[model samples]
Target: MNPLLAGDRDVVISAATASGKTEAAFLPICSRLAEEPAEGIGVLYISPLKALITDQHRRLESLCEHVGLQITPWHGDVPKSLKTKLRRRPRGILLITPESLESLLIHQMGWLKTAFAPLRYIVIDEFHAFIGSERGCQLLSLLTRLGFLLDKEVPRVALSATLGDLVMVGKCLRPAEAGCEPAVIESAALKSSLKIQLRGYLIPDRPHDEDDNPVDTVQNQIVADLFSILRGKSHLVFANSRRWTEYFAAELADRCAVHALPNEFFPHHGNLAKELREQLEARLLEGRLPTTAVCTMTLELGIDIGSVDSVAQVAAPHSVASLRQRLGRSGRRGEAAVLRLFIKEQEVTADSGAADRLRFHTMRCAALISLLLKKWYEPPLTGLNHFSTLVHQVLAVIGQYGGARADQLHRLLCARGPFQETEPAAFAALLRSMGEDELISQTHDGQLVLGVKGENLVGHYSFFSVFKTPEEYRLEAGGKVLGTVPVDGPLLVDQIIIFAGKRWRIESVDDEKKVITLTKAKGGSPPLFLGDPLLVHDRVRQEMFALFESGECPVYFDAVARDHFEEAVSGFREWELADRPWLVSGANLWVFPWLGDRVVNALAILVTEQGFQAGNDDGILEVRNCSEAAFKQAIKTHLAGPRLTKKDLAARLEGSPIEKYDKWVPKSLRQQSQSGHFFDLEGAYQWLERKTDFLR
Candidate 1:
């Protein structure tokens, strides 16, 4: 327990969640700061979340006080006075977020070196979050620029409880320049005693002649089941969506009132007021209130709510890694963590037997819990080719410096930033597009300068994020805005809708202006399908396949879930599709490769490239009218190649809009980002190669 220090070299501390890794990381940095007591910022702690910054600040502040040092948390919520204080007297450690850091780099360009002159250590908390996101790429570019500005080799330390691929995570953080050796400190010895239980709710089969409503019955059953769990233990119930969180919270509250139990439990999501979220967090952590808060991904990271008895996931917690994080929240402090997974039964026709339905549910449960027990979390992958982010960052850089020469910009962007591999021609093409769009101008000094449009974009808060967000109209009812809704769809007046757990009717809509007004109503609204595509990792699919093949029942499965798995396996065996690459049963042909979204997409491209018509829905990939011979041939060709070129991969992602600015980016760059190769192309290729056996 010598703190697992990585010395002067860059390092990674990958350990289980709730492990002493956080302390292990900070102890060395704090010890170093205490010994030196630098006048300027000694350490820069970058977290993916604003909440994490606040959480770590409190923890570090106490340690700072113990070591007689200073720590400051700087983000949007941090008072301007505190930032001014830091500017005037920079010292110890500075906890900040990527967005805030981006703002600081832009607004305080003159003070970049002075503000961080003494900065030596850079710790990226939850390094896993940064790996596969545009934000991660943005952070890498920003760090490179900061290093260039300071003209120093800063040691970076990445801390994460879950990492599917440690080498890739390290590579993403490592400087491209040679001689910068980064060490990885992986402590797999830290394990959690988590008892995960997968429970399936059976939906009574409705005959074709009967007027049966599955939604109502399922909703009532879910409410009753949720109440029973709440009655037993203090728990955290996770819903995949904000709307569901609200709906479930209201339903549970109503059920609790009927049962004469205290209705102290509430809902916590992004749309809720900051005060309300903080209050819930305080109550959960203090354990003063025996409550089960329904939440979305907002609660997945950062905010600590002490130890709870159990975690109940309304549906598959999206991914095994996410399930692990949610389950890890419970069972802290030597207590066994309990996770109850409830899967809503989907309607099935006579053609679809109990085995088919059970197969889907059981496989999902097995895959999720298996990965969690194996301690394998998906490492972050690179996102959509972000030429837009590149263009935006370039403009931001120009705005800060007034103007930058072409060579200087190229060196800064390509040699140092995340776009290190981007060619000069591509950069030139981007500049031409920007010039066409009037976002940047070539000055008489032969340097790139931000145009008026570029200045406006940089000034806007929305530009801070590289992700695309739909232009949404604020849903207002009774003078309070519930949340934003996509403006792309048509809205009819007087239509009843469910949002934030309340029923409302659209009073009016200004189609041209993209605004909608609403009033309280009972019921009569169509369900809104917000296209929130789940990122299914490649490993999850493999685990799902394993679940189907393996006769062993997972420990997490309840009676219904166990039955479901058994039935699904039987169905696979009956159809002889368990080992088949693709199965054609009637109109629906299911391809069970068990690959993540990216690889599936790649396969889709591969199929299309081989002159086969294909489409995908949900988790299944379909090739229209494909013969078995053609399918086998395509798989063989794909496996025969050493690897697909970046160009070929980009070709597959053509017309796939992942980010907001993606639609506007040149086809080439968009392809690169959408290919999701920022982490490791080799791993993805290997995953594809391994799946070729499934074709048999």
Candidate 2:
């Protein structure tokens, strides 16, 4: 606070939940602002979600009351009248999101320049949420642009509960030379006890037949367990996907209704209405109904859902960092942190693949939980090139001043901002590409301005976001809007869909109005929501192997899970996986690198380049028309040569749109950027080199 009050250095507070990180940052800010009040906005607090801003606004009101300062929440949900008032007479702190800030800079730069003239500090809450994402890059550029406008550096403060890589986060908060090294305030380790359990279930595969019932035995078991464990407790059940969240919540509600109990289970995700989501939050906080929210990552952040008794996960988390944060939400008010992990896998058959036989889901969940106990988490890696964000900033800059020279745009966006990796030649080429697409046009005065197409884009409210979101259609039942779901194809009138924790049969569909009328159905499968496959870490895979090698089971497993574990061990021994890493399927060969997705992906590329048809089946690298000896020779040769480049592998993939403006980017640059962000080339290479050593 002293250093921050002096305006000499930035600060980063990495502390546990409910540890007063917010107060530590704002105490100095409020004190300084109280001593010398400003006529305009003094502190800019940026959060990743609007709900977080709303929560913080309520908390800060009382803190700022005595200081004679005000804190205003600004986002799309904020009323226009309130925004107009703030524009006319701005004061104190301004809490906003990155997209809102982008819009403000583009559409209200003149107002913002004057309103934020006395800005002294910038606070980024949930700092872990922004790292390694395009949103983070945009925020960094936005902060730099703001400083450029004010002609002075504004000190920064970052707060997070689960920050794994301090060096990278620090660099993100205060880039080199822009500000002094941040003052890190890392809190002591948590002393509270933690109780964790890994519960596993086996679901048998049955042929799909329309005449058969739609009920699933695995889902039934999960819902039954939830009904028994969380009957009257305030808890949270986190699913990996929204479809599952809706399904599980609806299933639990059905179970409760069977016994004539109140509906205490709710589904929360991004598709739900603001009113509905708020209702759920309020009910959970009230502690009257013994509510439990079966949700996705929407509730993982700090939204003040009150003290939860336990946190249950449907499967292995994408990373240990996320699991730790979810665990932090519980164990409040001097209670032990309680976590229950439920891993469900298909029952293995004679023809089942190695992954299914070994029970990948159970192994992965066990490994992640074990690693968490050791305080080992996935570290932050270098991020994407963010060319899409650069294009966004270009249009934003053009909109800000109406027109600007290409050199000015490059200097402001690339040379000085987070897009420093972009070179001058690439910038020129990108401008040319945009001109060809009529996104930007050159004026007779040698300035660039938004063209007709670009005007239509910049005119739309959604243009402020660099991330791509699909157009959604509203779902209504019994004249009540349940929620909205993103549609990728045509919708039929009789199609059965699951949403808002219930099954619905489509009654009518209106393409023009983007609405679907539905009637309640008995049961149905959850809708498919496609996303990038979760990448497993190499260390996690290694840990899975180690767990199998050991003759002991974790003490936290229940009786059912222990039985499943014994079965998995028996099957593992029968397969003799410890004696060999390669399995021959006729003329083809499958190599178990015992590595992660990235290394396997790299290996697939190397095999393909060597004239072998290669693809990844589960965790193994399968090569067509290749023997074990040939595959080994190719890998050894590649390891002895020069390192692989992003272009070498990215070229193998089809040219799919990976970012918002990827279609606008040149084909070569798009692939290059995607590879740099998505593929772990260096990690893959090092992993293979070690394998080569083992082979020798």
Candidate 3:
């Protein structure tokens, strides 16, 4: 209950969503600041999103006012005058993001060291989002660097709605380079009843044309169901992708028009304009209108969007943590949280892949929901070599100090810092490449400073973001800005497209400014807002396998979903996958490893290295032009030969840039990082061993 409020003692408060985590953290913080006044900024509150900062500010305004403290929300969106005011007189709680904190460390070290001299505690909201990510890595490095500047310890408090890997969470909260052990405070649960149903639909095997009578559209039916279920009520629909989000929102709005009803559904995603996103947030907070936001993961976290009636998921959720987080948005005030899952499986044909025939999406979603019920989630990933963040941090350090020695950079970063997987040789090689590539320059006295190229990179606004931001074209219709889209291919002037939950006709195109002008159109498909797909965990797949192996029908399935589940089970048995590791087709093999994406990728690489064409498609490994016997032989030979480490497995990997800062790091080091993080070689190897033994 006390939160162990002692000097330099870290704490982690993990509880259910909408369970007053911010108040829990700030109560003690504000109390301490009020009871014992300190000069300069007393507390530094970090958040993953600028919107989250706004949400927290609104929630804590009255509380801070009651405690006689000022809370300043600092980010790119805040007015420069307000930021200037805060800079001139730093006091009370300074709410910021990692990027803004990075900016201060680089450009205002003199002011920051003084301002943070009396900083008592650092609080990170949505702590899970930062762990095992590039931004998270940058955050940890910034904290460590801040500690070095202060020459003393500052205790940290982390707040989250969902968490796993308690040990890893503790370690990340207080890295080896800072503070004491983290004390965890977690609640039992939400404890409310869950009202859930998974409804399935079937898409026609043949594509429908405009001339086709009685056109069968699974999407339309699903949208119709959504309109009937969510009309005149507030809800959140997780459509899994920007394309789906836009399409579903547009379809629901169109349905409202056809029925002569007010539009209640709106689209929310990363591509939308900031003002539009803020508008949606404001409407949700107003709590008057019947609003439903069809969104991607943007609304999954704890962004105070008022109370909602229910949550709907359009596709199979990638992770249990995400599902749990999305479900947490509902079931407030002692009401049962309602969930309606919509799953659409394409009609099977002769050329349909194994995943489609087996209804893999349905199985996977069922597995994730099961795990969510069991209160199990994937642990935070560790033992990764984030050379990308290391590259950014090294440049950041040089910028902060104006110039840094090689030994100091190495000592503060790779030696005793977070990037322990990087060896001295790899790091030295990276520095040499940086110098050669003009990312950094070495003076005659051997001190590292930002080169002309490095200065250009770091001075740019995009430099502050550790994650990759794709180049996109801003879309405008009439005088208002709609949203932006990444043009994957050439765009014509009269192209019709769906964006921002509206159908648009391209009026004109300005390639130089990367802007597309549009006019309202009747219908169009969503453009390619290309992004990396989520990786599925092995546990989810294992549960899917268990479902088929054990012949158990889940109670949450609807009539259509039950039919799909039964069909999938029949197909699984017919293919004889339960007895063997693969199914044999003419001159090809369908490998069912039932592992996570990374391990599947690792096996694919190994098979490809052995002179076979392989690809991991939708959790099923497809080996082209390789028979079961040949594939079996390759595995046996690999098992008998020298163990292939990550480096060895990566020998045939394409050395392209995956992270934002990968271009600056040496090719070999980049390869090493990818080799370590991109694949679970050990996990793959164990599965291979088991499969081969079963074959024998």
Candidate 4:
């Protein structure tokens, strides 16, 4: 509070979840605002989620009630009546999301300076979520513009739980300030007791000796386990995907019915209706109903879902930082944080590879847990161009000013903002491409205006977001709208499918309405949700290799897991995987780089570019129709050659789009965007040089 009141340095408060970091930021900010009242918005609070902004609005309003401070939550959901009031007289702390802020910058440019001129502090909550993302770049650009508008340095405060490299985060928080020193309050040393358990299950090829059927048996066991372990306790069950969240929640509900128990489980994810999500959050927070939410990363943020007794992960931990944040949700009341991990794998068959036979999922899960305990997290990747976001900002700047000169647009976005990574020649090339694609048009006086296509794009509501979201088909059952799922094709009637945790048979498909009508079905498979696989970190992969070599049994493993562990170790030794990283399968040669996903992706692309049909599955690089000698030569050639540019590698990518505006970008620019954002060529090159020495 003293430092903030002094207002000499920016502050970043890093603490564990539920450790009062929000209050730590607001307490000082509100105190200073009280001492020196500002007519305009006092503090601009930005978060990644609208739900979080709304939640913080309630908390901050109460805290600032006596101070005669106004608190307003701004997002898509907020009624226009409330927004109109803000537009007329924006005062006090305004809680907003980045998308809404972008929209405001576009729609209300005339009032931005007036509404934010007296801004004293800017608070960015959940700061880690924005790091290394296009949204983060958008935010930095927005802040740069705001600073230029007000012509003053706003004392910034960032609140986060799982931030690594404070120096990098500080630089990102204030990119406009040269050599900006941030007062960092790190609480990594704050220790909490954690109780974690890893349970493993192997699905049989046929449900003969184990049960009547494999699927039903596994579902019943999972439900029974949930009932026995987490029943009547406020808990969160996190699945890796939305489809799984719905499937598990519905399965749990079905099991409760079979056992004559009340349905205490609910599904929460981004696909669900906002009202349904809010209802579930309200119930969880009220604590009257013993509820458990089978959710995705929606509830992973600091959105006050009340004290969770424990957190259960359905698969391998996404990342050490993610696992740490999820674990922080528990043990908030001074008890040991409880983490229960359930790893499922199919029974090893004659055709199973060494990775499958050795239960790689279990090994990976255990390795991630061990590393997280040791307090090692993945560092942020740097040197991204973020060209897609630059495109969006160009459109936004045009929309904001109605029209602007090309050089002026370049100065506002490229020359003076976070988009400085965009070279001048590249910026000119982008403008020309935009003009060619009818996304922008030039006026007679050499000004840039939104083209017809650009107007049509910026006219839509989704244009405010820089991330790409697929077109979704709404799902309805019993005349109730359950939620939406992204589908790329048509669905026939009477097709049985699983969605939102229940089995449903499609009754009708309204193509024009983009809705699917369904009736309850007895047996069905989970809906196929298309998404990229979770990328494992290099350190975690290395730790997995070490786990195999050490042969130490983790204490958290149950009886079955221990058996699986011993079997995996035996299989690993028999297969000589510990001594040999490469394996021969038929005519194809598989190499285990044992690196992170980005490096593996780069390796696959590089090998494929070199005329070998190469792919990656479960962290192994599979090269086809190539002898060991040719493969070694190819590797040597790549290592000895110059590094591939983003353009060169992107040309070999089969033209896959990575972001929303990527499709609108020129082919050359899109290639650069995809390569720069998604591929770590340098990392892969370095790993190839080191890991291939054994082959030579």
Candidate 5:
């Protein structure tokens, strides 16, 4: 507090959820502003989600009122009247998202100097959410650009509950600010009991469609368990994706109807209408109803949802950090946190794939939970070039100043901003690519300005977001917006679909306007992907190896899970995985490098480049049309070949890091930037080197 309030250094406060992290950041900021009485926009408070800003508005409204300052929320959904009032005056604290801020930077560039003249501190809430993402890089660039309008360096304050590496976080917070390492403040860990259980279900190994209906005996059992335990409690049931969120909530609601009980379950996610999402949030916060919101990561962050009785995960969490965030939603107010994992595995038989035989899914869950219990989550993603974000920033800089020379653009974005990893030649190449794409053009006087295409892009409201927003068709029922779906293919009339936790019959499909009119549907649904999409860290897979090597059986495992794990352990020992990490059956050779997914994906591509068929099955590397001995010899021979570069590895990938601006970027430049973040060729090389038998 002393350093934050009195000094100019940046600060990062990491603490458990419901432990006053928000207050810790705002208390000092509010005090400093109230005491000094700054003129305009005293604090630049930023959040990752618009819902979070709305929640903060309610929480901080009274405090700002007491301190004789104004607090305003700004976003796309925000009322124009409030935005107009703020624009006219621009005083006190302004809560905004990265997109809206981008909007102001482009649309209202003229008013910013007057509005931000008195800004003192910049606060980023939920700092972990924006640390390593494309949005994170955009936020950093926006802040760096905002710095250009101010007279002095504005100290940044970060608040988070699930940060793994303080050093990495500090570097991200101040990428170009030398000697501006953030002062790390972590709360003392509280001693509490954790009651957890892991239950496993066996899915029948029958033929299934990729987009099949999410209804079966295994799913029903998991929902039945949820209905029995969480019927009359305020808790959060987290699914891996929105599709499963809808499926689980609808199933749980149907069960309540069957028993003549009040429907306490609801689905909450970003796709749902604002009114519907807010209603569920209010019900949970007020505690009037015993509501259990089955949701995606929408309800994962800290939003003052009151005391949750427990947290339930439908499948394996995408990452340890996400698991940590979801778990933090519970175990608050000095109560032991309760957790249940509904791990589902296909019944193992003779024809099971390598992933299922290795029981990779269940072992992944166990390893993640073990890592969480040990207070270790993944560190920030390393080696991100963010070429797409650079493209957005380039256009933004051009628009912010109306026109800028190429050298100035490069200096600000490449030299001084978060995209320092991009080389000068690469940056120059990007500018040329943008010109060819018609995103930007150079004037005769040596100034880069928006072209006709760039003008149309910067003119749209959607241009503010750096992440990819799929083209979605709105689902409307009786003139009310339900949700949206990204149907990549054509949709005909009289189609039955599931969305927003309910079944819907497609009444009409207007391709021109991109809207799907719907009516109340009686039954049936087509489920989407439910498996984890994030890459598994090397430490997690290594920890899974330790779990298999040791003979300790945790008490939290159910009988089914225990049997599944025991079988996996026996198979692991029989296969000699600890020593060899490879297995051969007939024509296939499976190599378990225990390397992270990024490296493994690169390895697959490199192996494919060597004229062999290789791909990643879960975390295992599978090579086709090769015996074990042949595969080993091939890898050794490749290691003795010419050294591979990121460019070479990236050239093989069809698509990587598909951000919004990636399509407009040149192929060579896109590959250069994508490779920095997506493919770890050096790691793949090192793994092959370690595994190759040099003595032979």
Candidate 6:
């Protein structure tokens, strides 16, 4: 082993997925443990997902036995007896999730020193997954607190497969003043010999009348075609949502039955029981049966499911980064990976014909694939302010320590966190807002503690996470509950809802606990497009503008996709869609300057800030009666300004609705907490810069 292992610098092992990144990270730590096996926990391994933690534990256990060290996994599912064993004889690595780590700090405050006294290194697996998220921010705060508690600098080692922005990840893991040196070990460039294939479909024409059955007819045809390709292959079919996963699974199975094929397929998503998910994973790994698992993003991560033969994506994956991860899952055994994209085509019979719709759909798929093939991945991080997460973390700190001084809390939060640049006045304003909200109570001794309301919040397991989840109503039938459906609005009696892969007719609703009783129904209802907001990086918008301007086509576009792209480009040039920001299509007017989602959001914010009535749906930013000249000027001015700093971008994200931690946190902390979420002002500026000339 290298003698430089005693150094205090962070190590980054950037290898491809399934390439022993886990072993590479753990080997050095285990080597140190061999030299000096500390009495207490010697290493901390943090993972983004609970499933990953469980998998890591098994892997670590075998290695620990080889090295004569004890390894333990501590998550919600881990038994209490195991935890007691660790507390009694703390040794080796302690695997945990961010929320579980927070629980330890909150519940086991007294054990902080003894348990972590021997801590030499903190290993964050899949560090890229945590970047630009509230969970990332929360983990950063926890790490900062742990550092403060240890009163010593801890070396952080981060392992990731696909990281588009390494600098951002470094900044997030270690602040500038911490004097931490990050070493990047990029092995992906060496190992990658990836081959990608893009598939295309034609949007079929439908009848002009409402009585036409082409929608279902077209869906059946698509499913049939997909089943033919999927059969006899051990593949993972990815759908964007759970309901779609179910629909596709059922459709594929039904198609199989009609074709007299064995019904060995399964559906795996978050809504399924843990047992079922594990069963599917085991079957896939065994490779005994010809089974295909239709799943959501649950299977997208680094969970080992053996080597999948191929991957079929249902629609356009939201971004190229996600597409790369999914595609990378296959082709691991020195063979080229195969990916088939099935785009569901729908035609607007009123004005836009099937050709136009198909061309547009084909263009989008081509654009995403082209971007990926050209080594460009979407870095569209969320732009919303995370002040709420900060609020929860502050409250969590006060709860853990019983009572903490105001200055200490502020300094600890802002000094080391991603919010290091946040001004004292803004932080004070947030604190005052929390004080006004009665979430924090100040004692006569001038210390801060959780108020009654805040105490109530921290009392629940749900308060541990900062991610926003809508208030959902549990769907039950004959005393056995199915799953949950979001309670966005009041549900009337007998309203049909589809959840957990089944359609249900509402029998009754208990509004108090937000539970809805239901019975099984025959026909499937339209799937709920749970308005998952998409962030568009300024880079993508600039690329889109480039796509419009450049005469040469992107090399990543496949032959069929390129033909469609050429058609779209021809149409855009003929209609002058690039120069004219407004084009009325069907019922809505599309304002196109080739900007991605973030700039569109900035434009929306600019409109809202400028006293103009505007709305957004899907990727379209809508405004009514606003002069074209004013919109052009706004774009030009924003483009001409100096690149937006992180703080300025975060400021733009202020005033977004608090999705998580229901009003218990102080407003100021909430704002500070939301800072780390993907509010890239520079990206926004770049996007606007590309569109300024077109706007004029």
Give the best candidate by lDDT: 3
CA lDDT for candidate 3: 0.81
**Candidate 6 residues 1-696, lDDT tens each?**
342266477777766677788887778779888888887888898998777887778767888999898888988889999999988877788999989999889988778678899898899988878876668878888998898888887888888777766655565678635555577666744224555555545455645453223344455666776777778879999988888899989988887788787886689998898889988888888888888999998888887787888888877666777777788778888887777776644433454432353254555565666677676665425334456567778888898898888788878887776556556776677677778777788999999888887788888898777786567767778998666766532233444455554456667767556677888755322211223444544455455556655646645455655666676678668767656655544433346535555455444544445554343332345544456666666556655665445555345432224357535444334433443432234544565555556665
lDDT, residue 106, model 5: 87
lDDT winner between candidates 4 and 5: 5
Q: Give the per-residue lDDT of model 5 (tens digit) for 237-322.
A: 99867889999999999999999998999999989999999999889889877999999889889888887899999887758888
The clash numbers for all candidates, in the given order, read 9, 0, 0, 1, 0, 9
Judged by TM-score, which candidate is best? 5
TM-score for each candidate, following the candidate numbering: 0.84, 0.87, 0.89, 0.87, 0.90, 0.81
TM-score of 5: 0.90
In model 2, where is the ten-residue run with the lowest total lDDT?
A: 523-532
RMSD of model 2 against the true structure: 7.3
Superposed by TM-score, candidate 2 places the C-alpha of residue 483 at a distance from the truth, in angstroms, of 21
For residues 1-696, could you state the per-residue lDDT of candidate 4 as single tens digits? 476777767888888888999988888778888889999898899999999988898778888887878888999899999888988888888999988888888887768888998888888999999887888888888887777767887888899998877888788777655698799988865445889898877777653542122253465576678778988888999987887898899988887798899999999999899999999999988889889999999999999888889999987775888988888888777788999988877677765545666787888888888888887777766556778798899998888778899888888787777777788888889888889999999999998999999998888899888876655778898888988876532233444455654557677777458677888765212222113435677888899888888899899999888888888888767767777767666666777777777776778778866777565556667676677778888878876787676677767543334566765666666666656655668888787767676559
By TM-score, how accurate is candidate 4? 0.87
Pairs clashing within candidate 4: 250-501
Score residue 360 of candidate 3 by CA lDDT.
84
The lowest-lDDT stretch of 10 consecutive residues in candidate 1 is: 523-532
Worst 10 residues of 5 by lDDT: 523-532
Tell me how far the alpha carbon of residue 57 in candidate 1 is from the true structure, in angstroms, after superposition. Answer: 2.0
Model 3 per-residue lDDT tens digits across residues 1-696: 476356457888888889888888888788888998778899999999899999999899999999888889999999998888878988889999999999999889999999889999999999999988889888888888898999977888888888876666888775664445588888777646998899999988665554344344787889889999899989999998898899999999998899899888999998999898889988887879999999998998788997789999998788988888899888886899888899988788766667878998789889998888888888887778888899898998998899999999998887656777778888888888888889899999999999999999888877888987645778898877777776432243443455654456668777557677898764222222122336788898898999989768789999999999999999999888788788876666888888888887778777766777566666687777787778888878877888778777655443445578877876667667766665778888888888766555
